[model samples]
Target: MIILHNYFHTFPEFPPECEFKYAPENVSRFTEAMLSGNLRIIILSLFSFLGHYGVSIFVFVSGYGLSKCYDHSGESKWYIILRRAIQLWKWLVPMALLLILDRYSGYTHFTYAYLGNNKIWTDMLFMLTFTANGLADRFIIAGPWWYFGMAFLLYVIYALFLRKSSDKVLWGIIAGVWTLLIVLSSLGLDNWVFAFRYNSIGWLPVFCVGILLSRHPVYISWRWISLGVVLFVLSLFNRYLWVVSPILALFPVAAVLPLARKEPLQNVLLFMGKLSAALFVTHAFVRQQVLAHDQALPPEISGLLYLLLCIVVAWVYRLCLTCFYKKIHL
Candidate 1:
């Protein structure tokens, strides 16, 4: 779904006026599609819906896994925070070096694509350390790296508050936080990309759903699936709710629970799951090379080639990562 946007969202046939429309405003492709009356854009916008939901599911699953493992006990809060921080930066440090090298060497243009100013290092340190993503979006060396900042923010929230809360207190906290968010969003906070897509507070509702489910495991029956579909459909009706479609989009993953026991399909699923973060972290670099240099290739063929290249690169990335860590003995 995300690859649909990454590889195939070039609406090259747009009228001249709309060619570079969304760039100045920092609006997303989804918003561009929503506002554009072009039929092709509207149809392709479904990919936006499905693709962005991946982050929501990722956060939710992170919350679930944390709750299941810790259950509000064990490690000290700072220890948990330190551990998560290491995990985030271990990837960022190497990836940042690769990006800087790419920028200086590629065209020898001395122009950094997303690295912008040298302040990226400072920005990343503060962002990754604190996950104060409101300021952290400026550290947009890789566009998707915003999620790492947000993920750490969520982790901090988990370590500091969530790990100690009772179920009732947790639900109340979720409601209270969202109520504040709704009011702030009504006052136009959603216009900021950070608040709209990268804020831990905005993401908390979905994450809390995972925590609750982990605390009280539920059966994934057809009725629950039906309810999930219904709520997801309803979320599309309202603008604010529509922003959280990821939460609603999460229900369908339950339908795939049975796949864990299947044959090659299970192996495929596990492989992708293990490599998903590596794929996301590295794909933008691969994409820059793929899309920029795929000269005059057919769109369908180029798209497939790009996808294949991403998986291959991600596998290599995984191997390199494991070897590096083993060498360091961390």
Candidate 2:
């Protein structure tokens, strides 16, 4: 069995106490590119191959990092969950305000086209309740919000597992959930199960892998890295196999962790990581309102510009938050 204990130790934990802290050095460039929508640098079709699977990798890392922190901390589970929700709200509030502006200013049609017809208030409920995946079709303004909801729910579940169950029981429960998802997928219920973001139990295995690795980290070896690459390649040929792709992708990511320690690359990753949450929340709006309406520019240029705007906007939002918090302290 491949051990990942040492790998987890080298990287920073997730849901970091400070949003601007240095990112986990092991984070894959492919993962970062997907979040930042910075695809122009990727020359191969690998970008398309990894598409949504990139999000799976992110989810896995989040679970691993959060579990690591939770295990080390003595705080109550409810308190940790509440803190996570509040952290998310800090990012969400500004985006929510922007969405409201988009609605009154007639940019609503763009989102409606992508997300289907749904009331904004209903979508907000889904977002707030962490049920966006279950009601994804109704999330007209921010389909990506499903990720946040699903991840938060996972955090809650993981916390409960840690609090109430032994590690062995937790493993058994994860295995049962994973097997059930596979059986359901084989029975043609995959669509329904996947519709509810929390029910994408295919990813639960990935999350479990993360949790296990955190508790019992193994040394990073070339053999493991090779296996991960093989699995990632296999996942490309079959969609059903994509469920494990994130776990496999981590091998190559781990292999590169050392290089990420260097000066410029480290700085770049930190900068991107700091803005990742904001970029993720604001990129869709920028694409819909700015890139989509600009017919004069080529799609590639528009995409590049859209990503740039997301970075600028996210930076400004963080700056404002910092100033506000400072003022409050004063």
Candidate 3:
């Protein structure tokens, strides 16, 4: 999304039909469908259904990787947390630049794009403080920001509370909290703003599963196929049951990573994993750029073109990040 937007902004070959059309109703429904879908399928469906949710797997895997590395090295807590925060800054700084350019280029409407101009303070908080879910609630709705923000929050919380906690106690507490949130969401008793706004609670379950995996790795084969099957079945139902989707999404973790491990394709998977974040942020922009340049393409073709661009943008962005990381001293 980010790539398309950036491309179209600079090219300006095809102007999109720009009469403002709000899709809040559709968004709300899709959000619900995401939550209620089948366990494994929800994970896979996002890759095809909307494409954004595929990165959630990366978020979990990233958390798992960070935790695993920290455990192996026995790094100081302060140092580890600082490093994680720095990684975030590494990505966000560039994004901030793009964000500013995106606005200046007229690819994005700063006023309406950000929930009225007065909410700049809130948006900055989300961007700076890592309250992505909060930002989604206030300005955007259910974008890739939520995954990064929520993952940051989980890392902080886990480091403070569960890093050295007994596995039994930590897993129990994690599952219990997830269960409570699920109950609240199902009952509509959740303080949606508080739960999602600060990135305090929405994705705890997924991250917690990753945390658990850090302690107790699952052993399995042919997991991705199983995950694909499950994800497909779940898409038929719905993805909107606030608490169910994340829980269902966990099954793939058991299946997908193990399969990846068994395959002798470490570098390729790592490359894809590393670029996952950049891809998540850029794909939407790429799609928008295509639409802007060739407005007459049918929506169906536009969607296909968007998917292809997502892959291209993600790969390109990954290469850029790799180069930047090597060139910079940090």
Candidate 4:
């Protein structure tokens, strides 16, 4: 969804006949572009909205995986956080250096925290520290690194507070937070805390859902799927719900993901899932380079090629990392 979402916006071409002026942010223009009778453009445009599910799923997965593995034995919370931090840093640091090198090689005088001396380092620091939530939605140039920061904080919250809480207490927190976010959003508040799509608190409800579900697995009956579909449909009609669509976006994905439970397809998914981290960290650079040199081709064709390049790059990255670890171990 992240790859496709970026591709949809990156291609940025309307059918030549349509003559519609559309910015990606303009809802009316997006509707007009979708109605332009071009199937590819319509599909890409729709995915730009639906693609939000990717982040929600990721957050849920993080929570679910941690809950499953976390030990109640005599282990320090800070030590667990350090392991997670190192895991994330191995994937992130190379990109930060590459971006720095790409942007500058000339000498500049250094200053306190390197704030004004070079603004680029600020981005690098944020990326490195997993605090890119400080950059938030303004981070088009920084790639999709905000999730790392928000995720790191989420882990800290889990280690310090959530791990010790009872399931009933967890449910209460989820309900209270969800209710508060909804009410704040309904009031059209502009605070970052109210932005359910971006902040950690906004995502807390779904993250807790993952923890709860991990503790007590449930069968997805037809009735549950029906309810999910109904709520998702109803969410689209209301202003506040639409703003927080990704919070419930998991419903549709959960409904669809079960279909790929068969053999070959399942293996293929697992392969790509291993490469997902590298793909997320490096795709912006691939997108930039692919578009820079390949403008002569059609948007749909170029977009597909961009995807191919991303997969290849991610595969190469994983292979190199695996070999590096192998040499170290040997």
Candidate 5:
């Protein structure tokens, strides 16, 4: 077993010397062009196409990081899981409260008259109970809340497996779950209402791959990365392999990790990683409000604006939380 001490640092970081500092000489025409709002919108829109894979990547990273940090220091597995859940809850609770306020204050329309009983209340219960992903329908308000539920479930699975199972056993279990999900999807059970269509069952294998990587941090060769690229291109034409596309994308990313040790890249990546949860929870609401108010705005521009607004709002929310905590201490 390769035990890496301080393996999973809290946030992605690089050597201090590699940090981001503006250099006048390094400013290029492309960089200047990126400063323009319209150009930025176009560029961001292109990147946004990759957004569907974000949650899958997050689960993979979480599994890898948690596994790397796992210690056999005699602490109870339940205690570790609870601690992580509390940490996650600290961020989630604030967003949940804001959503509730929006729902009740007529700022957001969560209820549809067509649905006889209020589904919003059911959504709220699911959100609070960390089971929101069980609601497979996309019409519900706060649709992104499903990620939290799915992630929470994955965390519990990771904790349990890490505590009790051997690496081979864990791999076998992940393979079993993956095969079952594929079988169900093949039988058109993905459309079944009672089934956990949006659940982590489909994602567990990806997460397990991450855990395996943590145990054996193999250097991904250029050949593998090239193969991954080919697979990704092939996936575009073959819809059946779409589920594993994120895993293929991750191969190139893993290969590039070493090159990204520079400070500027690290800073940007760290900021995004830190605010990812907040942005995920808040972006849908921001998008809805923006589109509702400005129906004429192009979808690309609206998406760019939504992203910028989410970053600013999430930053302010974190600032407010810091102040509140400071006041409590006083």
Candidate 6:
């Protein structure tokens, strides 16, 4: 809400075709300052951070969960692959329905462009087959969904390479590649050399780090604390340059996460973790439909509405998932 209010006059973050316009650039700072005189500035920044911070956590959780899944399923690799493929359909169908609504409603929003397209089939194939990360290195760059695609690809690569290879050699190669991508991205050479696909590559190491940690949980504790400090410093100063931050982001997890996998915390984490996917996909829609409005509600009021809507949507999604899981006996 602070971010939106900051740009309410101009909507400068979006392309020109977008419905909103920016206020004049010369206005010193955006607040209800010379206008409504009702809202506080600190609140907006807090909400914006909330909107952004959950993503990295989601990625970390995903890597950890996938490693556990592979370990526990004990089924053939092909069977595990097929199971994920089926899960993709559960999401793809809802996404399809949303796309149809956006297209038919003639909404010319950025979200519309991101989600509605013929390439959805291609995207789904990439998603279901876990080829998105490598394929996205060559093609699409839509939104947060790219992370899912990259995760899919990372899993495939791990299965094909590290699963059968010697652990020492596998971790060495993964770490080497992950570090290289981070250095290149941070140096601003990612676009020219890797066409900015370094970000996707960066995440590969984290996902593997999770896998490796799952294989040997005890070594992670102290390492996580030490590396976490460095990653925290980097996060404060550096924006993720196309995938490079994956190394920094994964370091703490590689070092410390085994401690988190213990009983009660594990159960809580698992429950919330299951909602991460549905939350990621649905959060944007909830924000748009319930939070954003054709007319401005005061920023504080709007922020409250937005937060409330997200909580409701998340709850509803949890209920729906629970019912669906029960039906399928998952």
> Which consecutive 10 residues in model 5 have the weakest lDDT in total?
1-10
Give the Cα lDDT of each candidate.
0.67, 0.59, 0.54, 0.68, 0.58, 0.51
Q: What lDDT tens digits, residue by residue, belong to model 6 across residues 229-316?
A: 5765345334443233544545554454676688888886676566656655555655555434633776456656765565567667
lDDT at residue 64 of model 1 (Cα atoms): 95
* Distance from true location, Cα of 325 in model 3, Å: 4.4
TM-score of each: 0.81, 0.77, 0.67, 0.85, 0.76, 0.64
The candidate maximizing TM-score is 4
Which residue pairs clash in candidate 1?
A: none
Preferred candidate (TM-score higher): 4 or 6: 4
TM-score for candidate 2, please give it: 0.77
The model with the greater TM-score, 3 or 4, is 4
Segments of candidate 3 deviating more than 4 angstroms? 1-56, 102-122, 140-142, 190-200, 220-244, 252-271, 318-325
Ranking by lDDT: 4, 1, 2, 5, 3, 6
Q: Could you tell me which residue pairs clash in candidate 2?
A: 3-218, 4-218, 5-217, 5-218
User: What does the lDDT read for residue 226 in candidate 4?
Assistant: 75
What is candidate 3's lDDT per residue for 182-216, written digit by digit as tens?
Answer: 45545655354245523646555556666678878
| Candidate 6 Cα lDDT to native | 0.51
- Report the error of model 6 at residue 76, Å: 2.5
Taking the tens digit of each residue's C-alpha lDDT, what string does model 2 give over 100-215?
55566754454324443447767776677666666534444554566677777777877776544567866885668656654665676645445533444445667777777877
* Candidate 4 residue runs with Cα over 4 Å from true position: 11-37, 71-74, 105-117, 191-196
Candidate 5, number of clashes: 1
Q: Where's the lowest-lDDT run of ten residues in candidate 2?
A: 1-10
Q: Model 4: per-residue lDDT, tens digit, 1-330? A: 778666666544532211011112445556576679988778776665445467778888888888887835466899879989988888877656655665555543121112233567666776677766765546634446667887888898888888878899888977787677666655655454434445577678778888888888988887887787778666654555554455567778778777768778899888889999988887766776776778898877887898899899889977887797688882
User: Candidate 3: global Cα-lDDT?
Assistant: 0.54
